[model samples]
Target: MNEIVTTRLKPVSANLSRHKGVRRHAAIFIAPALAVYLLIVIAPSIGTLWISFTKWKGIGDEAKFVGIDNYKQLWNNDTFRGSFGRTLTLLIAGGFVVFLFAFIFTMLIREMRSKKLIRAIVFFPNVVPPVALAIAWGVLLAPRNGLLNEFLELVGLTSQTRTWLGPDLLFRSIIAGLVWIYTGFFVTILMAGVDRIPAYYYEAAELEGASARQKFTRVTLPLTWDVLSVAAVLWVILAIKTFEFIYAFGGSGTDPSASSWTLPVHVYVVALGNRSPILALGQGSAIAVVMVALVGALIFLTRRVMRRAVVEF
Candidate 1:
């Protein structure tokens, strides 16, 4: 009877052990990451949203529910409007300059002799810290004593050496700096997109008597359309979050001037950034939430606009 019972149990045990047990173990493997994400990302985002509706001083005080009072203030504030407008200008104007130069650079460097070296040189700015880039440019554009103005003076263009950091030109300078820093990165991305086109496409275009511009329009642009779409989406996201470049202006606890302030700077100034008596914690949190929403909507719109049937090789 005991031997018969053992033989029966062996078959049941073998059946249970037939599989490698990945399904049962997968939950255990993923649980840690899920826990971290919930704690860090989800919890903080929820907390921020909650804070957006409250009047807490970012201290150990109980939050007072103030409804949309913060948002009302922001809506009326001229400073906020200018900041938002600057962000838009950066997104549109800066984007155009970055893309235009990036495309030109991609086309030019693709056919150059030392293309790899040039590529690395172009990509160096993307790796540099945003603050450092801003500081370096700021020094070069300093009104009274800058390398650019000095050079202009040396070249007998003394009258042209105006204040680059003044109110009239400060925003333009920032936009231009953004273009310079980002152009290389987009160029690299576009080069990768264009490189994937097999040489035979160009050969066919040539056989059909296609001009240089015609080849670009017909073969290169069509094939790399997907990459261009992706690059535009990425650009919009990065441009929206532009903080460090403008924030570097206000070093240490000092806030950037109204003229130089971007949305992120505005958000920072409202929260804990105030040197005044009252800290508008709710207002800053609301601004951040609005920005998050804006970025999401733009990303969704970008995907919708750029969506197309895949052109597989």
Candidate 2:
């Protein structure tokens, strides 16, 4: 009877093993998404990298594999170099200026009697279309009839008037416009962080004879460091990827000397424009890969530099 019972249990054990095998099969179903990701994002990236090693002019029945020539050309391309320098300038100016404005706005909003109206006004620019902002800015900065130059003329500072959209002034104007549109977003994010901090801390600091500036420097800044660091990284990426506003404001394609070109604009001019017969698929890919590396490095360094343990209140 015991032998018979043992024999009866074997089939039950086999069925349990078969059920586990079915669960494993179900987990394999996750492969479809992974496969799609590889095809759409990974495969394209790999193709671009391969093309960068070739001298393919965007469209032809045949592509010649010219190893490292595209990269060598990039090093000597003055146009690409200029745009790269401007990109750096935008990151520094835009990143710091926006953060400063956002910090001040958040502070002022905390003490305001009517917060909603102020917030709506400040953030209104963010909702406006980019094309609209570019157009409005163009009107405001027109040398002959722009509001800014006109005001200067009224103040007997007519000598100071210059074409704000001229080649010399285009980059600065673009930076200013971006700052105006982007500062409010950072302000809103920061205000949320500020709101989370306990008011009792400020109250305690006040009782301890701390000035408003001291309280902000000692308490507020430290508490908000993580959020600010995140904003900085985001701004850096935005500045590097800046394209639409530049193109919308300045006519697209490579200019006489690429005066207002950023890296993205450079890619468009080389890869898509009819004026340049050079197919920049490879170079564009290289630029994109380099950009990704640069951003990744910056984020890693910032996290290291801004390292702080989260404070629980």
Model 2 TM: 0.83
Which candidate number would show the highest lDDT if scored against the true structure? 1
Q: What residue runs in model 1 are displaced by over 4 Å at the alpha carbon?
A: 1-20, 250-253, 274-278
Model 1 scores a C-alpha lDDT of 0.86
Candidate 2 lDDT, 166-234, residue by residue in tens: 889988888898888888888888887888889998999999999979998988988887787787777
Q: Give the true-structure RMSD of model 1.
A: 7.9
List, residue by residue over 1-313, the lDDT tens digit for candidate 1: 9999987778765766666895677678899999999999989888889889888886887889999887887799898889889988999999999999988998888778998899889889899998889888888888878989999999999999988888999889888888888888998999999999998998999999999899989888889989999999999999989888877854433677889888888888777674652467787888888888888898899889888976888
Misplaced by over 4 Å in model 2 are 1-37, 252-257, 274-278
